[model samples]
Target: MRVVKRINALVLTGLALWLIGTSIAGAAEVNVYSARHYPSDQAIYDQFSKDTGIKVNVVEGDVNGLSQRLQREGTASPADLFITVDAANLQRVKAKDLTQPIESATVNEVVPANLRDADNHWTTISLRARVIAYAIAKVKPDEIKAYEDLADAKWKGKVLARTSNHPYNVGLIASLIAANGPEKTEDWAKAVTGNMARKPQGGDVDQLAALAVGEGAVALTNTYYYARLKGSDKAEDRAIADKVGLIFPNQDGRGVHVNVSGVALTKGSPNKANAIKFIDYLLSPTAQEAMATKGTSEFPVRAGVPQPAGLPALSTLKVDPLPLTKLGELQADAVKLADRAGWR
Candidate 1:
């Protein structure tokens, strides 16, 4: 009887240990493959972990690199979610049929119709306006009022821009195609190329630096690039930020063209439920505000979120109402148009 009771106690202890191990194994965790390498994103993950007790594992890389990696991983990929910088990149992943449609009340409530994928494959969390930045000392504010006006003869040899091959530029051209017909867009591309102050080179930030040093009087760039500069701790960058003024062109007609940094769940995500939760966390009011203030100086996608101080109000600017998905579809055409126009 003593031997039997001892055996029973051992069995019970083993069972208790197994139960505890199972609970630990079942604890929720989500894996994220993201192109946005920002400290604010890490903050969001920390907050989400605190709020939900679910661990977030983030892996960062270039947008195209992450997308290709997802494709290579196929169904066995450990990635629960994917985030990227542009709508075009999001569309590329969607085109691969690697993303599953998400139905989350948080996403629908936070993101506007134009900023998300129609099939619910992805949703934009933040927006960056493509605007004209001018050297404050050289260009008069009233001289440049619209995107079309940039092609005017007087502006020729006075503009600096990134390569038309850049995704941001291509997205802006795509917006032109949506607003005007293809013929008009093609002409505009050719005319703008003629206005180049120098051969298109470098990123948007480089264009702003050029404007500061008088390399060019005006530049086509996104708003956040200057915002980033202004927010930088480096004094030289801040000085450059001081020299340029942002102009939301086409405000009178079709407001400014905006692009987004967005996210989606892989179609074969092993943890679909956890992926949805992660996306919802990103759209939460706390997350939205965090993005505006801490992540990128970008405007939040969520309605009613306060605009970051010193930035133009989203409501006041007339945003082109083109669906973001169309931007991806027109990307190839926009690139071809740039090539044909010799906008290197």
Candidate 2:
């Protein structure tokens, strides 16, 4: 009877230890509400979990909507991080007081000074250039060498762009404002608006498609869209991609404007340390490599890692020196300019 009771006590102690261990592991999880819904991120997230024991819980939604949700939830919100594509989206969140400023030596060391927020509220993870996708048949590479040329009379009714309010277009216009004052950028806006092919319908990929169909001669697009089309399994996608040529406009001047995808910490995160750890992990070489090669096909922000495969070497193109944070700063002005110019 004594031996049996001793065995029973041992089982009870083991059960309690198992329950405590389970509780601790559950507490190690971090919740993220991200607008970055890229499918390639799944493997990266999985790898992070494998490398470190912390689990990631992700809820994907539009940045504006998700930020609003966090605002409503306030301190009660479960979100520890917000990952979004446009710098403008990060600004929106910061404006609403939904994100907290975080400092990490790893982040500052890995990301460029201009790519991360000055206050350390957010940091860019990857980059993509907004460039002119010209039709080889209609225009020679020499014919379209600058973004300013899009407004030239020679290309009137030949321009292809998404709606004036697309984050990509707005960011580009904002960069123009940073490079050339608002007066010049606004003038450029009015001229470019008059050059649109057909009321600016469809996404970047659609514009490339229109270029193939001869609807437009020059389509303004981000490079990755062209890359995907060029690499697509579908013959139709590859065929459209074939007729398209890219011009990294303003190379002799301000260089091509770029947009970035960024990550930030939630204001009242319950897991701030873990969140920072996750962000640090993302900025590490392993994560940067994966994000650059497999995810968006955009240039990685960190040094040493190469830009996406098949994309041009980062060394070859002159990057615009204007800090991307300016895009968010001047976004309101850009929108108003686009509106006044009747660039609907």
Clashing pairs in 2: none
lDDT of 2 by residue, 35-77 (tens): 9878888788888888888899999998778988999999889
Q: After superposition, how far is residue 1 of candidate 2 from its true place, in Å?
A: 12
What's the true lDDT of residue 340 in model 2? 88
lDDT of 1 by residue, 29-101 (tens): 8999999998888999999999998899999999889999999999899998999888999999999988989
lDDT of 2 at 153: 85
Instruction: List residue ranges in candidate 1 displaced over 4 A.
Output: 1-4
TM per candidate comes to 0.95, 0.93
